[model samples]
Target: MDAWATFWGWLFVLVLIVFAILSVAITIGGFFDVK
Candidate 1:
């Protein structure tokens, strides 16, 4: 049970990191006028 909990915690943190990176990338792209 402990191992499973740790695995899920790590997975959640990884997903959060990925989401943050994606959001930052989108925001930066929005700043530039690319047509």
Candidate 2:
């Protein structure tokens, strides 16, 4: 159904957002961890 497809599309978008945020956080932390 159209509604089902829309729901899945939104879920995928949310997951992508979370993944991007995590990647940025890790990169910043690694930069400051110069030990």
lDDT agreement with native, every candidate: 0.93, 0.95
Per-residue CA lDDT of model 2 for 1-35, tens digit only, reads 99999999999999999999999998999889964
Question: Could you say which candidate leads in lDDT?
Answer: 2
Clashing pairs in 1: none
Displacement of the residue 31 alpha carbon in candidate 2, Å: 3.0
Instruction: Encode model 1's per-residue lDDT on 1-35: one tens digit a residue.
Output: 99999999999999999999999998889778463
**Model 1 residue 11 lDDT?**
100
Query: How many residue pairs clash in all the candidates, one count each?
Result: 0, 0
